[model samples]
Target: MWFRLDLRTLDNPALWEASQNGPVIPIFIWSPNEEDIMPGAASRWWLHHSLEKLGAKLRELGGKLILRSGKSLQNLKSLAKNTGARAVYWNRRYEPLIQKRDDKIEDELKKIGLEVKVFKANLLAEPSEVENKSGLPFKVFTPFWKQCLKQLNTEKPLQPPINFEKRELEPESCNLSELNLKPNHNWAQGLEQEWNPGESNAHLNLKLFINEALKKYTEARNFPDCLGTSRLSPYLRFGEISPKQIWHAIEESGEENWKESQYLTEIGWREFGYHLLYHFPHTISEPLRPAFNRFEWTDNSDHLRAWQQGQTGYPLVDAGMRELWATGWMHNRVRMVVASFLVKHLLIDWRHGAEWFWDTLVDADLASNTQGWQWTAGCGADAAPYFRIFNPVTQSKKFDPAGSYIHRWVPELRGLKPPYLFEPWNAIDIELSAAGIRLGQNYPYPIVDHSKARIRALKAYEKIKK
Candidate 1:
């Protein structure tokens, strides 16, 4: 079994099929060259631990996972030659470059008379399976998801294989440490504290979300202070759990109208992101809407730096950036606020924000990352309108009324009260002194005035509109 993103044992169609054929030689080839964009630091950290967990699980089933690096084709050929393995089976990945590479590999393997099979394991529905009334890929989410809801696979996920017929010849394998997936510095300490990356933990988190947070998800999810959202993105990204498993788990939850639940809609959005990526691959770097190609964006390094370092002086934006830097994750609502601040308030390129998130987020996925940044920047399919610039202070007060979320990540502002907490510059000298704040000293003043920034962004939008 050639493992790429599908890292788990259960519901892994490729692994199950390979096991049924005969003795399984599960191999993971660490070929970064095959990836369109290399996995980021946080992603690599998660992968390192996840691989350890998967190796242990396979060992329990009386099998070993072979680890190899460099060209996938060369490694696979060498392994097949040594083990006398005649067939290759694996799950699929949907990234543009990875898909092309896999197709070429499959063709080459077939030429050598090796039987190759690929199965869909990660997404609930293949991108090719879903379409609009005209039979073209969807540009809008509602109709696309409505179509998907009709055809979504209701089958229960496959159970992990109980029996393992280990091959007698163990091909030479490299140790997991040799992959150097983990970072060299101590930056990953916060990530380790916040996450447990593995198949088992994925299920546990799903169960917790179902029992504790599912009902209140609609309202509570907006508040970053509450643990209202399911923290399962990284797990899904690495294929520790399949979307099919998540869908079935909710089905068995006995929630009334579970299919149309808000939580499921979020899952549908993930599917939608992949759908857009598969159909409109150029949108990975370019805007889906052609006019945005000529949209002028500012090149302010200082503003970009402030937004990245969480020194934007906008409480919510700063808090979210710091949270992402510290924990390798940020609340979804805050992500929009920060992303909008970058593209609209700062007028920096959306690609810059995308690239930064690609490096920082543990759950950073190409399709999702590209879709989200473009959406926030008002450039991709079904994107937020460019005229709708998010006011960071307004969003801060609305979602984080108590300021608890801001306090947690931006502790320097913890002393400020209601109005001033969200916007410290608004505080009177007495209030600022009472709250132990000194604007531009410890806490930063607003980097760009919301009223001014909004007007600037709108004027820029006018250029494209014309």
Candidate 2:
């Protein structure tokens, strides 16, 4: 069975069922140039480690993980031919490019007389199955989520396949070093400190989050400084964890707090995103809301560079962007604020931000990331209203009231009073100097005035309103 991104076996419907058919030869393919398709350097690093762990786990179970590279179809065909394998199996992936690739592979393999099977294992339900009463995909979230709840008759998660007999298949695998992915900065040090790769780590993290953090997640998730979230996004994106395991665990935890509702809703948001991707494949590169195509974005390379490097003179936005650059991850709330700052405040195109996130976020799933950027930019189904631009200073005070998160990521401002840290430009010289704040040195001045930018954004959006 070929595993693309789904690395873990626990609750993996495809992997578990494949073992039932016969002796299973688990496999992973590495494309040297495919790292470009990955979310970012940190994601590639995580993939390398996850693949290593997968190999070890399979070996322990007396099965071997075959590693191959090059064109996925060409590589798989060669492996099948060499082993005289009759069938290939995998969980289905929903991205347009992936769907195209899989279709071609299925046809090629069937013509060669090999049984090809694909299973739905990633999402809670097939995206196409949860349409509205009219059999049309819902563009908005609330109704879609409500429909999803009605359709779910979830089963308990499956245990890891423990009884697999040995199978021998060893083809050349890519040397991890050849992937050419490494952080250009020191940001990923914390990522290494925080995350452990593979299925076992995914389970350990999930259990830990459920046991200690789940109840408080609704409150704590907004603060970047807190351990209020499952931190399972990367694990999920890499397929080191399955959604079914997460679903059942949440169901069993039975927490009756607002946090439970909040976290589950967040998961629902992910489902909503996948649904959009499955139904509207072109939405990846095109705006889901056609009117958004008319919005005029600025061609300000200077502003774009500042935003990318997390130096936009807005502390909260800068901190969030820097955090993403350094660690390849950003808090959910911060994701919204920073995305707003980019598309609304800076007037940059949403695609530019999406591309950067694709290359930087460890948890970058094409469906989720594209949808998220579009949602923030008011170009997606049920997107945040375009004129509802986030004020970074206000967001900072509201979410990180104490400036603890700001101090952590924006350490140069560590000396500032909590009140002024969010907007040091307004501070008296004495206060600024005491806080080690310099107009362009200790902390940057606000790049663009919030009120002015908001007006500009509204005017640009006005063109599309009709």
User: Which number leads on TM-score?
Assistant: 1
lDDT of each: 0.92, 0.83
**Model 1 TM-score?**
0.99
RMSD of 2: 2.1
The per-prediction tally of clashing pairs is 0, 3
> lDDT tens string, model 2, 180-217?
45455676686687668899989899999999998888
RMSD (CA, Å), candidate 1 to true, equals 0.9
lDDT tens per residue, model 1, 1-466: 9988999999999999988888888999999878989889999999999999999999998888899999999999999888889999989888899999999999999999899999999898899999888889999999988999999876889988755646565788999999999998999999999999999999999999999999899899999989999999999999999999999999999989999999999999999999998988888889999999899999999999999999999999999999999999999999999999999999999999999998999999998999999999999989999999898888988999989999899888888878789988988899889878889999998989999999999999999998
TM for every model, in the order presented, reads 0.99, 0.95
